[model samples]
Target: MGTSPDRSFFPGSHWLYFSVYLLAFLVGLPLNLLALVIFVGKLRRRPIAVDVLLLNLTVSDLLLLLFLPFRMVEAASGMRWPLPFILCPISGFLFFTTIYLTSLFLTTVSIERFLSVAYPLWYKTRPRLGQAGLVSVVCWLLASAHCSVVYVMEFSGNSSYSQRTIETCYQEFREDQLAVLLPVRLEMAVVLFVVPLLITSYCYSRLVWILGRGASHRHRKRVAGLVGATLLNFLVCFGPFHMSHVMGYILGESPVWRSLVLLLSTLNSCVDPLVYYFSSSGFQADFHELLRRLRGVTAPSQQEGSMELKVQKEGEGQGQDCTVQTV
Candidate 1:
């Protein structure tokens, strides 16, 4: 039997990976958390179909960000897995699952928008919230089933090294491992990434075309921004990572630059909030309100002055003078 191939690393790659992972964790964690809070609030007030989809998307991004520290530590340890081997497959599963989950949710969101625009009467008659929930469930099941391959590949019992002796989490594949993994990677590129991309492209194209005919300029502009951000998330953030899968399968081994491309995938968590901002006006309003409150907290005097001015305006309208009374 052929031995496992040695994985090559670019010089200083670990530090670079560690830096990007840390930045993503720090930035994405708060952004997705805020999005989660906002979506939950919006859902409580009104359970809109698009809000439900965005909520699922927010949760998926949070899962990916929460599990990100494993990769961060692995990178910080010079691309070594110092933790228990059991965690390798678990974290790998969550990481890849959430990546494809993002794609699926984005595609579903586009379809929802397209249907609402293209067939409003039909969309109103449907149980949209229930459908969104069902779609979200299917997305989770499908992604989880596909990503379960991580466990099989990791614990295939044919590793050249013992679990304790393994230096990396998911690197250095043997011939048998490659045989199973490469084909699945190719399949994933098609099913999880490519098909979703094509579907998203079609839905958004039709959405834009339909909106152009009668939607107001501001409304159309927002939709345009939504289309641009969603496509950018897919093509810029996810394109290279999935493309690496295709290239790896063709090359019969993982590409040396696959790790670099994955950095872009990590960035999707941060970019998703932009998609949410464009997808729903409620999200934008809540986000701006949060920012406004934050600013008020930061500048107490300005807040007080604004409050006093409001009182003065009300008092003046009532033909009475208002004074600032300090406690």
Candidate 2:
């Protein structure tokens, strides 16, 4: 198959995109799948929200890896998209769905964290696992529906097939139809990028503020460092991609700029699990404890089974008071 015109549309991107896609998939898939099992199997004692979110994020990243293989193949083969035309739309839809869901879950985690620290009483009153499960289901449904807009618009069309004699699963935006394309692009930017970002930033900022006011220097430093890493990740990995898209919408989409945006966006997927580990105390503990056991640092923590973990600080040297307190 010849490289589609779109392949040549952004020359030199194939090499970079293929490299990034392969790296992300190879790294993210197993990491997330293992995280999924650990969160479900060992970390079950934590809050339902935490577990549910871990599951959701795992699925998101896993789905990205699943969809990426084809993309990697396409890029390696110079964007010829050797897969069947029918597979294109499905692939594109699934790709967008997974990424948006990842964003959604990340934002949700931030909100949950903010409440846990800043509004303890309110956070405690919120539903546990059952509620979190329902919310997670709702998130999946909502994300699926929202991202399916593209599928709905170009679900099946021989015009993209018969006329061009080229099959594409994803519909190209009509470059001339600025009115229609612009609004949809704007909405995608807002829902998938801006809104999630604002929510995450607000929650993390509030969490940092609350933690800063507390007395534990060790805890504060660790949490601060994690939060800083997380925030930096968002700014460095995701911020530029969305900002570039918005800039393109306002200014113009030069090929070089678009390729750069895509590159940054791809980098986000690869870096996200590290972000999760750093942003979350629970994750950091779990991951560190896992590595330590692997390296023979210490024995793994005894398996605490099937009860919620009531988060608390180090013991204050009181006998009966050593029981952990929930927020």
Candidate 3:
């Protein structure tokens, strides 16, 4: 392995990660919270597999956003650990676990959607929601367990009081052995990337096939939109991040790549809300309705007030001097 001089791990785009975290904090939390409310609100009436997966996805996104504050602190302090050094590994573990869980559940959502649209009758008859919930819980639990390996390895922190008092977080190699990194890195690539990618591709392809073979036009169109949106998000939001990791794994990791990796990793939270918007028609309609209500509520009450004022003026102008008031 090759090594490079130690410098600011994230130099130019420190601002970018911080900004993305701010955005993730703003958009992701609220959207996922709303989704959770809506899904749980109607669970008694409609037990849907897709909704279950969506709930999982939303919760995962929420958890991922929860880590942003610590991230922002780290970035704002110029990549130094001002807090307890023990917290570093825990934070790192949570970060990777959340990422893995998100990918796993997104793939599950796509597969569930595919099955619901492509095999409606079978999907209805089968124990879909129950099965899906079990699977989702397993995925999250498994991801947590897998990522806990870092904690098990007991990685050392790079703390220094020189110049800037920097304390960098990194996994310590056992016995200075490359094999130690190999297993965890491979596990991450496989669980987080390979499996999810295969499932997504397969599900979307099957959806396309079903649509091509004369599925309902409305359903086909909706599914096509979903597939397009999901694929777009998978490519734009996640593809670069994982691809960069693959490159580093295959080529090599230098200090220069660290900034880029962090930048890509931080972006998934921002882009995922867009994916959620596009994938779920119910959510889109509800979100639009919410916007309309908000606009109506905040429209200065100007239109209604003006109408009331006009009516009152006209009433006063009458001979009886009657007044009409809005109740």
Candidate 2 RMSD computed on C-alpha atoms after optimal superposition onto the true structure: 14.4
Q: What is residue 251's positional error in candidate 3, in angstroms?
A: 4.8
lDDT of 1 by residue, 92-158 (tens): 9999999999999999999989998999899878747887899999999999999999888877885
Comparing 1 and 3 by lDDT, which wins? Answer: 1
lDDT of 2 by residue, 1-327 (tens): 111336444457678778888888787777776577667654446555766775777777777788888888777776666777666667777877776676777777777777777777877777577867877887788778877766655544336565334443343444443334445655776887788888888887877788877638876776666566556546766676566557656753322344445555555566667656655567777877776666663322332321223222222334345454421
Write down the TM-score for model 1: 0.87
In candidate 3, residue 101 scores what lDDT?
A: 78
Q: What is the Å distance of residue 255 in model 1 from its true position?
A: 1.1
Looking at model 1, residue 194 earns an lDDT score of 92
The C-alpha lDDT values of all candidates are 0.86, 0.65, 0.67
Model 3, CA-based lDDT = 0.67
- Candidate 3 residue-wise lDDT at 290: 69
Candidate 3 segments whose C-alpha is farther than 4 A from its true place: 1-12, 153-166, 171-178, 215-218, 251-255, 293-327
- Cα distance off (Å), candidate 1, residue 192: 0.7
Best by TM-score: 1
